[model samples]
Target: MMTGLHLVIARNNYVKKLMGLSIFQVSVIMLYVSMGKVHGGTAPVYVMGENGEPDLGVVYSSPVPHVLMLTAIVVGVATMALGLAIVVRIKETYGTIEDDEVIEKDRQEEEALADR
Candidate 1:
């Protein structure tokens, strides 16, 4: 995650920023999945006691985090696709995906317009 954050901020290429964002997102998902797992945990099946109440001594892990991560994975894919699409549009408009170059071009265009 730290590496991704560094790349996202330090890189000048728009594609590298997207790649860093993807890495950070994957690391977060992995962290959540690992946290949801227990050492000796089993599936979340409940056992019934003789008194008809659910047994409370089970060491089953909750499925909520895993389920939520599944949704997150889907959303992450969609987000990546959208980011790539935007980058494509930026490249089309600016003819370069380098952040510095794009900004320089915009500034130059502004200067030219000002002189006119």
Candidate 2:
């Protein structure tokens, strides 16, 4: 019985570790996107030429990365929302939020069912 409980606890801890890793990965991706926005050039708009014609020396900032980041943000939010919902369901079904507790409860329930 003790061995069975230990196994359950170990499995739960592994799951929690995996979830934490996923959160870390998301944070890193967000950081990368944010760091890509900094620019040292002037705006891509024309002010005036030497003879008042038009100034074409101004550099336009790239909007491609920003647009991609917006898409990534939306996708990340949706993924996080879905993951949270699944976590909520797991908690409700197991009657505990801690990974080990949930696994232990599940093991006990399974044992009870098998004894019948």
Candidate 3:
């Protein structure tokens, strides 16, 4: 029962940490997206003119920030997925993913090995 309780707590902590990281990443992406806006500029799309030609006077904010942010988000997602996969493996291998418990268990193993 005690081990079960500890497992529950460890899972909760991992969830909290994951949520915190997600929020932080979202805020950063939002900042980048916001920077892509210009006070008086329009989107980078072509406007049709009477002659079926594109209007040449449309001002647009540079799409650099928006594009960069998109790339960052893609990379971030991939990295986050990899990290979570590793964490899951660790939890399975060690039987617990809690930092304190893992460290304590490691020390116990080291002492036991030394005593042999």
Candidate 4:
């Protein structure tokens, strides 16, 4: 809900869009982590009994989701950094971070080119 709200609240600002994207990424990470949890479940470590038989009564929760979410966190950070860098470049080029303003500038440039 918050993710959708952030995305919709600031449509014209590039920096706000990046922040919304970062929030959405975090929400997804949280969802994955939450789904990985199991009630009354232990780690995926197997113990051997006296007869060298693996314990059959133990319920092991998979660590795959948690590990994948960790990787996702790193990737999300990198993506956010790259996005912010792009926004900075856009601000420099357009003299504003507003999406509408940038589009207007591009349209004016195209009109000038058409007249030439």
Candidate 5:
């Protein structure tokens, strides 16, 4: 039942639909971040040993996933920001965020145009 409700909510055509998508995107990013972390590994920061040499003995976790997720997070934030901006514009123009209403409004406009 809960899953069905979420599907309905996600399918709605309101402006700011990006807000819902952003939640899923963030969750995926978190999953990637969790997958990137190692149980016994240290951070990727560079450190010099007492001998003034880079320590290579310690087991370092893979950096690829961490780096990739970081990039994805940045892109996701930018994408969300853009979606919000578009939604704001949509509300300002249509005075409503609902998709059904917007489509109806357009249909009426088209009919009025056809009548002319």
Candidate 6:
């Protein structure tokens, strides 16, 4: 049936949109994490030299990236949660979760309401 075909197309579109959004979120997190690392920073270990003095000249790796990454992770989770909420709403408003079905149903409802 035409409705079935429409549902298939709508579902595909929704899936594609979801995939794109996911990819975008992942890319943003990766970029933020990558930017957080210092170029030549040494590890944070305090090693004693042969002379019996602690080598403190070595710059420890920057922790800014790690901190930012944590923030990004939180943000990413929030975004995903919000996105899923929207999907749930869309599914609820429309009898079918398919894009085309929702549109068609909305159209029919509008027409019926208008006629009344």
lDDT of 6 at 66: 73
Q: Model 4, residue 115: displacement in angstroms?
A: 0.3
Q: Residue 86, candidate 3: how far off, in angstroms?
A: 1.0
Quote model 2's TM-score: 0.53
Candidate 2 clashing pairs? none
lDDT of 3 by residue, 19-60 (tens): 556666767778887777665555557576688865546545
lDDT of 5 at 13: 62
Candidate 6 per-residue lDDT, tens place, 1-116, comes to 33334443444455445655666666666777677655445455555657876555544455777777788778877877787778788877774556677788889999999999
Clashes of each: 0, 0, 0, 0, 0, 0
User: Which regions of candidate 1 fall more than 4 Å away from where they truly are?
Assistant: 39-43, 46-59
- Candidate 2: segments with Cα more than 4 A from true spot: 1-26, 34-61
Candidate 1 vs candidate 5: the TM-score winner is 1
lDDT of 6: 0.65
Clashing pairs in 3: none
lDDT of each: 0.88, 0.62, 0.69, 0.81, 0.71, 0.65
Best model per lDDT = 1
Pitting candidate 1 against candidate 4, the one with the higher lDDT is 1
TM-score of 3: 0.68
lDDT of 5 at 48: 62
TM-scores of all candidate predictions against the true structure: 0.81, 0.53, 0.68, 0.79, 0.69, 0.59
| Model 5 lDDT, residue 86, Cα | 81
Query: Order of candidates by lDDT, top first?
Result: 1, 4, 5, 3, 6, 2
In TM-score terms, candidate 5 sits at 0.69
Q: How close is candidate 6 to the true structure, as a TM-score?
A: 0.59
Output the better candidate (3/5) by TM-score: 5
Error of 1 at 80 (Å): 0.6
True-structure Cα RMSD, model 2: 9.0
lDDT of 1 by residue, 6-29 (tens): 989999999999999999989998
- Model 1 TM-score? 0.81
